[model samples]
Target: MGAADSVTACLSKGVGALVGTIIAGSKSFIAKAKILRKTLGSGMRQVGVLCAPALFTLEENKAKILAEGLNKIKGLKVDTASVQTNIVYSDILKSSNITETHLCNILEAHRVLTMPKGPFKLRLVIHHQISESDVKYTLSCIQKAVNGFIG
Candidate 1:
């Protein structure tokens, strides 16, 4: 083949490979989605509500709020040396008398939210449903609950 024809052939082959790869990837993604929907018993549902646009907007701002709230806690320390994610973990060694259930109840009463990681560890998660003020209020509630439990 001539030089120009060789270059054209190479370009056509590259484009063909790219198209094939994209088609295969799409098929794989569709298959995975089908399997997940069946497993979750959502195959019959025509509409799925993962999150609305407003909730998506809230989710985009959740990380900063979580970081600020985690910082406000006194003895509860977080690993901030690395890039932080949406979850916050704190050690409860200072509040030995505070049970996980009690902490959960205190959070419930304050309309905050948290979960236990272990005997002396607690985990907090920030989501689109929670606001920055909620985080601050939760920290305050935790502080008070811990003090009351210790005393």
Candidate 2:
């Protein structure tokens, strides 16, 4: 396998292991919760509040939105090779003429949101509050701002 494939495989395995651990631990906790519920009369009430289904649904929806938005950006590249779970790794070339801080400022000014992971790296995420239009607008704004800065 090539370098990208190797990295992808490694990340996939690592993420799988981590997720397995979390699942096993959660099951263990559920057993304890069951015992506590019977002893404290808080079984159904507390478990209902957790809402694991809703949380998982939200996670899936957010991932879909993010994938759509990331594809919309022209110059920014997405590296799907190393992505295993919701976490995505991408790279921005130094020649892009776009500083990470400039992008951050543009997003902030537009009231959109993102996080910078490196000097040339940016991370945009989707959650309940963000929409597709917001992603498009943020990308347009970043393009305009970077062009203006370069000019």
Candidate 3:
């Protein structure tokens, strides 16, 4: 989209390709990536078997990224079963040693925006604009913030 030389992104994001990524850019960039993939022993054939379920799930539009986020951090209590929509509400446990404002600030530093629902509650609203990779990044940042605050 930009005038950049190359672009690489996780396939498991938005598209739900699961196991691989789509690389697009200059011819030389693609060629070099193929060479690197082969060298790393990542070049594969018939990967469709692993991708079928991902495709079906994407078609059904049933995958929610918040569930993955809810599973990554220990200090946050989120009911995965209750997360049937785009909004995720997390309860910041006292054991985390961090308040809602602290967590929000930490995530904001990483460019991941979040809302403090109350003194100890966090509210995250996911829209179609937010990709799976974005969710993953947010979870990682939250985990780091919690760990940093505790240790």
Candidate 4:
């Protein structure tokens, strides 16, 4: 970050940090921020408990695992190379005879969660807690759902 640049990032949802954010910037910005923090009485204690898992999440390759599995499923298109993070976007093909919402519902019935981005686009997020086995199960469920829709 530049001398004038300041950034605030939330660690609650993706990294599994239930609460907390990181505020960082140049020395001048930090000096001003500290005074503001003191004025606002914003103090924290024992934050390492949440920070540890967030750190762990950064080191994980769970998103790649899920993205590769998604690429193998028929009637879906996933550019695995574009998966640089924990989010995977899959486009449902016309051959699948399935709408995004319908497919999302089917996956949800199988205890898998996904979000529909559009009529034929689905969004899946890989979190720190999702395991390889979970990815396999999710893939199996999606393959079955797509095949059922086409057949």
Candidate 5:
């Protein structure tokens, strides 16, 4: 419900993840904040440094990156128009003969990390830290992985 919605919304990078809404003067909000602060008590120091890069990343054209860049990668089934933000749901077709886990393992072996959503779906998060070259490299890696699995 906070910043990591995966929806188009400001394209908040993982560094800018917000777990709760900040509504000033709201008693409920204050109570929730207190509970989280006491219960969670988890945090990182010098967050401002991370936010600096996050702010820069949020400025790029996420829509274009997903639609034109990611979708263009062959073998990854993605409906680009539906991609309004930084999150992309990529599918490894069943016919591809590679499970999402295997694909993820292959990608990880090549230093590319991705999350497997299901038997064949992957939840891909692209931040500004990922460049066009990175995208190309990722696609190529996946393609190679699929090929290797098939062979």
Candidate 6:
């Protein structure tokens, strides 16, 4: 991954500096990468400045705000253990009668944006800007969306 893609938990496009390090000890790999990079185009500028916010966001949201916030929602099913960092994979209960696309459409209609991963799954990206109240509002909106689709 490029510098920006690794940082910001991949949220801000390619803005921040690189995230992790590669421990490869081969000059062959390095030389090949150097040649390949030309085809990948040039790097970013001022992305170093973006790294500060990206680091802060990753540190802040990853610890407490990710799955803990999402799992509290009422009709949504979240595998709490599967939540590793700032991403939450949401599943709708079969009994809820709401498809992922329908839920996402309803949520978007209510001004709450969501990304659908599959017919039954949604991918939620949590960031530092999302407060506890924001999570509550999201849940509330999801509830409303589900209600709209149910009837």
Per-candidate clashes, comma-separated? 0, 0, 0, 0, 0, 1
In terms of lDDT, the poorest run of 10 residues in model 3 is: 54-63
Model 2, 16-126: lDDT tens digits are 221211222355676775586579765354543445533453344544445444545555666654443544434555666677777777668777666889878877654
- Every candidate's lDDT: 0.56, 0.53, 0.72, 0.81, 0.64, 0.63
The model with the greater TM-score, 1 or 5, is: 5
Off by over 4 Å in 3: 1-63, 149-151
Off by over 4 Å in 4: 1-5, 24-27, 79-85, 149-151
Candidate 4 structure quality by residue, lDDT tens digits, 1-151:
4554788777665454566677888889989998988789776577688678777766776777888887788889999898765788999999878889988888998899999998799999877778888989888899889889422
For lDDT, candidate 3 versus 4, the one ahead is 4
- How displaced is residue 86 in candidate 5, in Å? 1.1
Candidate 3 local distance difference test against the native: 0.72
State every prediction's TM-score relative to the real structure: 0.50, 0.54, 0.55, 0.75, 0.58, 0.58
lDDT rank, highest first?
Answer: 4, 3, 5, 6, 1, 2
lDDT of 3 at 25: 83
Name the lDDT value of residue 20 in candidate 2.
Answer: 15
Tell me the deviation in Å of residue 51 in model 6. 4.4
Tens-digit lDDT track for model 6 on 90-133?
88777777788888877787767789998788887665567767
Cα lDDT tens digits for candidate 5, 1-151: 5653222233244423332222243567666666776688645566577556555554664535654554554556887766655677887777777888988887887888889998789877776567777877777776677767422
lDDT of 3 at 11: 46
Clashing pairs in 6: 3-18
Q: Taking the tens digit of each residue's C-alpha lDDT, what string does model 1 give over 3-34?
A: 33111122112221111111123556767756
The TM-score obtained by model 4 is 0.75
Which 10 residues in a row give candidate 4 its minimum summed lDDT? 11-20
lDDT of 1: 0.56
lDDT computed for candidate 4: 0.81
lDDT of 4 at 150: 23
- Regions of model 1 farther than 4 Å from truth: 1-61, 149-151
